[model samples]
Target: MTSNSPKVLVFAGSAREGSLNKQLAQLAAKRIEALGGQATFIDLKDYPCPLFDQDIEAQGMPDNVLKLRAILAEHQAVFIASPEYNGFITPLLKNTLDWLSRPYEDTPGLGLFAGKWAALVAASPGGLGGIRAMPLAQQLLANLSLTVLPQPLSLPGAGSAFDEAGALKDDATGQKLDALCQRLVDSLAKTHG
Candidate 1:
């Protein structure tokens, strides 16, 4: 990709070994690269931080949180595949976001996220496809000053959505993912141009 190509950080809220959200995130990263953008796919399991606490902040940010913030600061956009937990965002994601939203050193609170773009997707085995958590996730991102895309993808029956090759089994579902990645890439062009 060119230096001008959009750099996107792609990750999933769930870090379980066989998480459907993780599969979705991996697919998104590949699609982003195919569309000529750069995708930095990460696993939250690698950047573990404690639940957000003022006491911890007073001591100093965790090494992992600092590393994660640095990674985020370098990207122009983020693509998240969130898994729902009881009609809400996963606690891991919420805690991570909370930590990242804090001010560190000279950077202001939300500095890592403000004015950046974000796209969200979710996958679940149930019929709703984790749709119940989309609005909450969107609102949280917006509150951090990120401009979230309007059309979020929610993949229901995720257990069977992907083929053996890790590609979506449905043509229509694949097309939707392509469209979302295209929109993100196009938005970067518009903003950067």
Candidate 2:
């Protein structure tokens, strides 16, 4: 009922090309691989769905939603890098979680997120580092019975933290991301087996 490879999924919750949150996710992936975990990032751009509707539900769930759930089923843990939209979690991120939680109660691989560990990270040009989104993400994961790590890194001033090639430039922020990602790797290692 488990996998041979240790799966560490990374969710980049922002949709902008200049998304600093995505950079944090990229950094997390590097650290995951460094710690012997397989890192996979689920980009929200690839997971766009309309506002959930009962009418839409009557038509059956969408293929893209199922595919995203399948990706969750493949992983043992998650590292979410979310952007704050209108002082809350991005609708894209929330909607993805919504689709992932289909059947509301019992379901097949949709249960993949249950009991799985998750870590939070955020990046933004604003002073708060897109942190406005963290509480909601954590709560939703908890509602799904996912074990979310408490150490969240809200990466403010993210624009200066990376270079032209997207490499992390700030040693302090890099170290922070390193520590957060290590937690994910350790959590996955402990939980996957």
Candidate 3:
């Protein structure tokens, strides 16, 4: 498509198959692509990092961590859908971000995240709709110097929210996600287009 669309990276905190967070992240990716933007959908499963350990880092960063960092740095915006675990971000997501926050050679500190735009979305089977996870994730991204979008998507009772085809069954909820995606794209263009 001959469109002025920014590159966006979309990912979920969970690595398990059939995770609601993954489904939501995919939906966000589609929305971005539908707007003529390039969306790179990444799975944390592909980039496994041991729990953050200073000793491990003192030796050297993992290949997967370096690969993930390079991939993230290519994008202008990020869309994240994190599953809530005991009212917090999943450990996998936290560790990945921790690695990304570290300095890399030839890049400024927080190179993967600095000046990037981010939007958060979450899906949970519980009543809170994964809203609780957004704050910590938002704070982390903000600390990395990303301009986080204030509005977020929290899909409660998400177990039954998607259809067999994986699209949100409720049109209204889907619309909210659409808006969030558009805002991310627009915000990125304003800053980095």
Q: Tell me the spans in candidate 2 whose CA falls farther than 4 Å from its real position.
A: 1-3, 104-110
Using lDDT as the measure, which candidate wins? Answer: 1
Residue 158 CA error for candidate 3 (Å)? 0.6
Tens-digit lDDT track of model 3 for 1-193: 2445799999999999989999999988988888767899999998889899889989998999999988997888888998989888899988998898887788766877777888999999989999987899899889889899998999999999999888999999999998888888777777766
lDDT of 1 at 147: 94
Off by over 4 Å in 1: none
Q: Write the per-residue lDDT of candidate 1 for residues 1-193, one digit (tens) a residue.
A: 7877889999999979999999999999999999989899999999989989999899989999999999999999999999999999999999999999999989999999877999999999999999999999999999999999999999999999999999999999999999999899889778854
Checking candidate 2 for backbone clashes, the offending pairs are: none
Error of 2 at 103 (Å): 1.7
Provide backbone clash counts, one per model. Answer: 0, 0, 0
**Candidate rank order under lDDT:** 1, 3, 2
lDDT of each: 0.94, 0.78, 0.88
TM-score-based ranking: 1, 3, 2
Best by TM-score: 1
